[model samples]
Target chain A: MDSLTDKIRTLCTGLLKDGKVDMIVGFKKGTIPMSSCPCVARTPEQAKELIWDSNCTLNLANYLTNRKEKIGVVAKGCDSRNIVNHIIENKVTRENLYIIGVPCDGMVDKRKIRALFNDDITLFSEENNKLFVETASEKKELDKQDFLKNNCTTCIHRNPVIYDELAADPVEEQKIENRFADVIKIENMSSDDKWNYFNDLIKDCIRCYACRNACPLCYCPTCFVDESNPQWVGKGQDINDVRTFHLLRAYHCAGRCTDCGACEEACPMDIHVRAFTRKLVKDSCEIFDWEPGLDPNKRPALDTFNPDDPDGFIK
Target chain B: MKVIKIDKQNWTGGIDKSRENYQIFGPVKDKEHFVFKKLNLKEYPDMENALSVLSPKSILFPQSEKILAASLDESQDDHHIMKRVATDYSPRAVIGIMPCDAKAVQLVKLNFDTDDYRDPYWCDAYEATTFVGLAVNKPSIYDFTLSMGSGPFAEEGLDVLLVDCKDHFLAKVLSEKGDAFLKASGFTSEADADKSAKLINEIKNQAEKAIDAEKVKTEKLKEKSLLELHGASFWEDLSFSCINCGTCTFVCPTCWCFDIQDETKGKKAVRFRNWDSCMSPLFTLHASSHNPRAEKVQRVRQRFMHKLKYFVDKYDQGTMCVGCGRCVVHCPVNIDIREICNTMNSYEAEQA
Candidate 1:
């Protein structure tokens, strides 16, 4: 797995030196422990700073939106999927992208790891399947498999659907047994319980739009929250307004979301914001027999109407 | 000024008693993080933790609040007119607030409260509450409060400052509001003022010394000019990783920008204000669609300049930041403000 880092830098520097792409977008060492930051390298020298690790949780597809310069981006399974979504949606030109793909294992959940260390993980290092953590007083090693983020644990794709270059050999896709169990739980609840469940889920929202900004699908020039002619949602701290914003934002990505966990990772509040988007993913899977971002030629479930589809709900 | 001591067991009793007269806002453990909640009767504040995910600023300047409301009913004479919303401005107490967060509220008050104009909602909320702060005895690596003029034990904005002595809390009452709050809670046992002062100074010195060891100083920032610092070439590299999300501003104790809008539900209209961030492109967008800060760099530059330069020039007090390190810890990309502050502070004017 460490060999992938060398391959990434080699590919990035080659592109930059040969003028194959204007910039190489990848991950760099983060100032915070157990995290990696997104980086864009214009010079070959800067490409050496790039790192490849499980901590590269942010989707590189987020950086590809409407970009003018030809870019070489490092993508995992989820990121490559989102790139396909972007190309199909006409958000970006596929010709301009040089996708360097990585077969992913999973990303760590910082919250879960922190709890394991009693919330004092200040220093960290990773080995084969063990994570070494330290506090001011002591150090400990724990199994990394126990701390994978919820989205990554259920990921069906471990290899990129589309890519210009492969940094390493592809890994096998997972057989997720309970992918829709959470959404189904909420679906079975009574109307009042479901309403209360979702309301409490988003009770801590500060309306910072981290969830929206982190998503590759949310590329609108003017979001509904900023519309003035007929403001769809109020900007105040009202719980109703907060709930309205989340529900509407989730619906906008009904068939398009890749379930990449970028929104959940970017959220400072640690909200399970995917609780709303995953339901859409389940609907697309069960009703339309569709998986988004797998094939660009196929339209999303919501984008086109089928004559054979049930017509009673259309009206 | 007076000093009092309250037993650890009686902390809940104090809060339980205070609920008789004052509404209580305090930090409570919420799943993986802590949040400031309006506690129900007999509920005790979560004093076990030193900091919360969101600061206590929402007590005075909530993320969302109603300022005015209107009705469309034809029978009323004031129909079609907006009227001030009925709000409870009665005495309230926010316990378990950090001293840095309290100082941030005071810094934000300079914007909401002024000689020429006043924000009625914030001002009213400010006047109606008593701030009870908890001093940080052991500071984190991210804490630079000592370098920013507000130490872990600074009492500039707090009415009653509590120093945890493990078994009991040494309460230092600094203002009349502190006296009223203490009285309501039935905390009548007074401690020796001189003894309490000596103990507080010991913790204060140790925490400040720890911060000084980090050496993330800000004294040089005051000497730099806005134009020279703004033109520095490092800003592009510094802001490169930024996703332009509102995580930094929303978690900050001092950031106070807001956007106001009206919402109508069944002919009843409400005017409310929600938190806004300068990091967003929409923050500076004009009605003509001509945005001056259209680029992400401009927006990023505005946040640091406002905290480091604009606020310093406008207030003549200090930088708007209290250095609580919420933004430093919670930034998705690990864009530390301490590094940016150092860059701006030490930036030399280019040779002409």
Candidate 2:
């Protein structure tokens, strides 16, 4: 990973020095351990601060929305897909973006790691497939596979679909048999149980909108929740308002979502926000035989019309 | 001040007894994190737990509250005229509140309860409740209370400071409210004052030492002009990762901003005060469809400037932060306040 970090820094530095882009957006080592925050480097010296680690969980495509500058962005598997979605949606032009792609393994879930200790995790480092965690009272070595984020564990895309440059050799993608098993479990529940399940899932929400803000798909200048004239959702934490916000936000991302897991990662309450979007992901796949962001020239399933499209659900 | 020795065996019974007189609110295990909620008959506060995910500020200022309400029907005498809504102001006690959170309540009081104006809702709730703070003997890595003018064991805004001494708790009664609550709980076992004070002093020093290295210099902030710090070049890079979400402000103990809205059902209309954040795009939006802090950078700058500069200059309080570290631990993009504070404190504007 250190070698990967050095390679990325060198690539970004050369790009900036040659005036290929105005800025390079990448991850920088955070003040706290196990945190890599998004950063924009405009100089060769600043580019040297870029890092590559499992802690880089946020989607970099979020910074590319309607950006005018010729920018070089570091993209992992999910980020590159979102960038394709952005290009197809006219959020960013392909000529302006220099995608430095990374073949991702997976990101570790901080919530899972924090749950293991009663006190704060003083030190966290990763090497190969092992995680070294230390606290004031205890030290433990754990398997990285056991601590991968839920979305990462089931991901089939380990290599970027589009990239101008490669950070490392491509890694083999996972072959999961039952990708939609969790969604199926919810689908099997009774209507009342489903209602109770979703209610309980989002009951802890504080309406911070972290999930919405973190997703690259949520690039509206004025989100529906913010519209005051004909407000679509209330501003309070009422259960009904929270449900409306989550369901409506999910519907908006019906076919465009790439299962980036940025929403779940950015949620402060650790809510499994993907539950809402995963259903849409499965629906888009089964009904339209579609997967989003695979081709930049192709329109999304929901945005286009076709004679063979499933219309049984319309009734 | 009197120190009461509460044995572990008597703790539960005492807490149960207190329920007869006051509604007990304390930290309980809520799924993944601890939260302050009303306790049932046998549910005691999780004293061994670390900080709650959200502060106990909700006890005084809820996330959503009804400040005023009105009806649209003409049959009512007060039809269109808004009136104060009814709220519960019963006697209650917040048990096991963090010392930093207790101090945060006092800092927020500067805004809600002032000489010129008093927020009726906040003042009423504050006057009706007592704050029983729990001492943090084992401070987390994120805790910087000592550096922010409060310490793990500091008892500035608490009625009583409860220190966990392994097998028993050393309850240091600080006010008349503390005494009355203890008496109501039937906890009259008083320990030797001099010896208990020495023991608490030792523990306080140890906890404070753990966070001593986190001290951020804010004296330089006082010397720099507000415009100079506001227009600092570091603001852009420092706020690049901000997603313009309210995660930081929502979890913060001292963030006390709210937005008012009215909801209508049939002929009834009720106004509500909902917790609002400076991170939101609409926070500074005017009725004329113009927003001053329209850009994400401006919104991000406002949060820090208000916390670190504006509040410091206006109220002369050290800063409007208790250093409870909730914002640090919960920020999705890892936007740390400690780093921002240090940057603002040490910033020297380039001479023109």
Candidate 3:
């Protein structure tokens, strides 16, 4: 972990100092445990602050939106995919971005770590693919694979789809047949059961829009929630409004979502927000046989619909 | 001060007693974290857990609350007109609210119950609930409430302060509202006032000592001038990772910014107020499409300045923040306010 961080900082410094990029975007050690913060460096001195680790879970592609400057960005597999999505959407130019990609080991879920201890985790350090946690008076070690974030464990893409520079050798992708097991559980339920299921899931959402704002693809000038001409939803905490917000927001990402878990990561409420988006990812694969951001030339599933598109659901 | 002792076994009975007269709210275990929710007859609040994901400010000011409702039918007499949503303003008690969150209610009150126009939704809710604060025996690492002018046991906005004593609760009743609550709960056991006071002091001193060890800068912020601090030029770097999300604002106890909208759901047209954050670009966008604080850096600076400087200067009181540490913990990017506050406080004006 330490060596990777050093390597990233060295690369970022060279990028900034050589004027190859106006800025370098990466992660730095966070004040809290088990996480890192996104950092942008315009100077070589600032570039030295960058680090890399399992905690670099936030997708850096969110920062590339509408960026005007030529810059370098540190990207993981999901982040690189979203960057391609941005390039295809004209939110940013391919030439302006210098993507330094890293093969990923899933991010550690700090919330789950806290749950394991059931107390304040005072000191936490990761080494040898295991977690060493210290509470007020006790310390324990746990296997890292057991604690990998739910999103990462199910991820099929552990290597970036595109990169200007590879920080390290690519990691072998996971082979999992049951990636959509949770989504299937909801799908198997009766129609009323599904409605009730989603309602209960999003009942606690405060409508703060963290899930919407954190996604790289949600770059609307005026969000539908904020529209006044014909308000599609109310600004109340009613279950109907909250449910509508989550459903509509997920529908917007039907074809473009990469299942990066950035939306779920940003949710303060720890809502299984992915439950809403993951269903869409499954349908896109089953129906359109299309995966997003694999090629720069290919558009998203919804962006260009074929005349031979299946009409199974329409009838 | 009225000091009362209640046996742990009878605590639920007392809470049940109050349920008949008032709607009872307390922190209940949600899936992974805790949230302030209305209690059932047998449900218990876990005061020993980490802070609620969202602050107890939601007790008085919900994320979205309907203020007015009316009919949209053209044949109706009062079409396109709004009327007050009849709310139950009956007395309620929120148990297990943290001391810092209680203080935050007091801080946010400056905006809602001011000398000018009053926000009736907030004011009515504030008036209806009695705040019961639980003392923090072990403060979280993110907590800097000591420097923020509120402490774990600080008694600013609370009616009663509770100390968890393993087998029982030591309740210090500060106001008549608290006394009335206790009486209604059928808690008649009174403790020796001096001895109870001495015990509370020992616990408070020990807790405060631990908090004082991790000093988070606050005092020097008041001494800095507005212009120099605003132009300090480090704000962009500080807010670099900000996704401009509403997590920080919605979880905040002191962030009271809200937007009012009217929506017609079926036949009912309702006006609702939902929490809004200054970090969002839409928060400042004008109808003319010209926004003064359009830039992310400017919006970010406004959030801190309003919490740490503008509110201080305008109210002639302290900073607007109660420092419950929700934003520091929940910000996806980990934008620590402690670092920002220290920078603003210590920034010096260039040689004139």
User: Where is model 3 more than 4 Å wrong at Cα?
Assistant: A305-308, B72-81, B265-268, B350-352
TM-score of each: 0.95, 0.99, 0.96
Candidate topping DockQ: 2
For candidate 2, lDDT tens digit of each residue in B50-152? 7788888999999999888888899988898889988878889999998989999999999999999999999999988888889999998999887788889
Better of 1 and 3 by TM-score: 3
Residue B51 in model 3: lDDT: 88
Stretches of candidate 2 exceeding 4 Å from the true structure: none
Q: Against the true structure, candidate 1 has what lDDT?
A: 0.86
Which structure among the candidates has the greatest lDDT? 2
Candidate 1 TM-score on chain B: 0.97
DockQ versus reference, model 2? 0.86
Which residue pairs collide, candidate 1?
A: A237-B64
Q: Which structure is stronger by TM-score: 1 or 2?
A: 2
- Angstrom error at residue B273, model 2: 0.4
**How much is the lDDT of residue A156 in candidate 1?**
93
Worst 10 residues of 2 chain B by lDDT: B212-221
Q: Native contacts recovered, in order, as a fraction for each?
A: 0.70, 0.80, 0.82
TM-score of chain A of each: 0.96, 0.98, 0.97
The share of true interface contacts that also appear in candidate 3 amounts to 0.82
- For A51-131, candidate 2 gives per-residue lDDT tens digits of 998899999999987667899999999999999999999899899999999999999998899899887998988899899
lDDT of 3 by residue, A24-140 (tens): 888988888777899888999988889888789888998977677897999999999998888888888889999998988888888788887755677878787988999876798
Native-to-model Cα distance after best TM-score fit, residue A9 in candidate 1, in Å: 2.3
